[model samples]
Target: MEATVASLVEHGWAGTTTTAVAQRAGVSRGAQLHHYPTRAELVIAAVQYIGAARIAEIREQATDLPTGPARTAAVLDMLARVCTGPLFHAALELWTAARTDPDVRAAVVPLEAVIGRESHRLTVELLGADESRPGVREAVQQTLDLIRGLGLADLLTDDGARRRALLADWARHLDARLGS
Candidate 1:
């Protein structure tokens, strides 16, 4: 799975073949074929595998953060990191490929939905915000959307400075609204 994600990020979805993944993983081609009979299946499994690892990492990182305004910043930082990270890039590659390939789209959409829900749940938990308040969920969703857009910009060029400025501005607004 690690090899698969690395391949996807390094080479786009078109280059992420089962043969390439097996070679990178140092596994026999036969073994790779036995495990994943089709490219769609392999890609789907890799997506799910990486998604699980990412969710676990997010939960683990959130565990140690002190709850307060600090936690809010930490959570935002974590989300930003995820947006700009290799996993997200690999997922983007998959999404782009899925657009033209019905088989890939069928496998990716449900997994993407699951990951999206999990991300939202993680953000809400880490934010420790009062969900009872109106607009809280919408605010979080908007923050996510902003981060995703920034991350996409990063794919084209270095946008760290801009992303940081935007994040800082959003953090202040979120702090005021969410009260932490």
Candidate 2:
């Protein structure tokens, strides 16, 4: 799965073949086929594996940050790292492939649900409030709203200064809101 995702990230789903994953993983093609009979199955499994690992990392990082501000900063930092990471790039590639690939899209649903729940939880926690709170919910929404645009921009644009500014502003906003 790790080999599959890395290949997907480096070379979009259209380019990533099971044989390549097998070669990268140093596993036999027969073994790879034994695990996944179809491209869709492999894509789905790769995505799930990547999402699980990313989520685990986030949860672990949050464990040490009980304070709202620190947690907020940490979450944002994690988001930045994820956006820049190969996993996210792979996911993005899969998303594009999902349009024509029914199986790929189906696999994405569960992963997206997990991400949504976690995003909400992280937002509420770092904001020192629950989603039930008016501004708290909005702040959480805003944080993600910004990420949606920024994620795409980060990939398409090469303006490092702008990206840095956005990240800095994001950190500042959370820092002020949490006031740790």
Candidate 3:
């Protein structure tokens, strides 16, 4: 699965073939085929596998964050890391492929929905933000959307400085709005 995710990140969806994943994973082609009969199946499984691992990492990191204003900064930092990281990049590859490929879309949409929901839940939980509070959920969603957009920009060029500055500014606004 690690090899599959790495392949997707490095090669994009079109280039990430089952044979490539098998080679990267050091497994026989037959063995790989046994587990995943089709490219779509392999890619879907890879996304799910990597998504699960990323979510676990987020949960683990959330446990160590301190409460207060710092928590807001920390949560934003974590979200930024997640959005700009390899897992997200790999998922982006799948999403891009899914735009035109029905098979890929069929496999990816439901899994992507699950990952999106979990990501939102994690962000809300880590911030201790009450979704019931007016505008709280919208604020959180905005934060996520901003981070994801910045992440896409990062994929295009060296935008670290801009991303950091934007995140810092957003963190302040979010802290005030959520009173975290």
Give a tens-digit lDDT track for model 3, residues 1-180. Answer: 889888988988778888888999999999998998887788778768877877887887677788766778889888788778888898888789889999878887887788789989989988889999889999999988998898899997878888888888888999878865
Candidate 3 pairs with clashing backbones: none
The clash count of every prediction, one per candidate, is 0, 0, 0
* Top model number, lDDT: 3
For model 3, the local distance difference test gives: 0.85
Instruction: Indicate the TM-score of model 1.
Output: 0.93
Top TM-score model: 3
Worst lDDT run of 10 residues, candidate 1, spans: 65-74
Give lDDT per model, in order.
Answer: 0.84, 0.72, 0.85
Taking all chains together, each candidate's TM-score versus the true structure is: 0.93, 0.82, 0.94
Off by over 4 Å in 1: none
Q: Residue 92 deviation, candidate 1, in Å?
A: 0.5
Q: What is the lDDT of candidate 1?
A: 0.84
Model 3 TM-score relative to the real fold: 0.94
Error of 3 at 118 (Å): 1.1
Q: Comparing 2 and 3 by TM-score, which wins?
A: 3
Candidate 2 residue-wise lDDT at 64: 59
Q: Output candidate 3 Cα RMSD.
A: 1.4
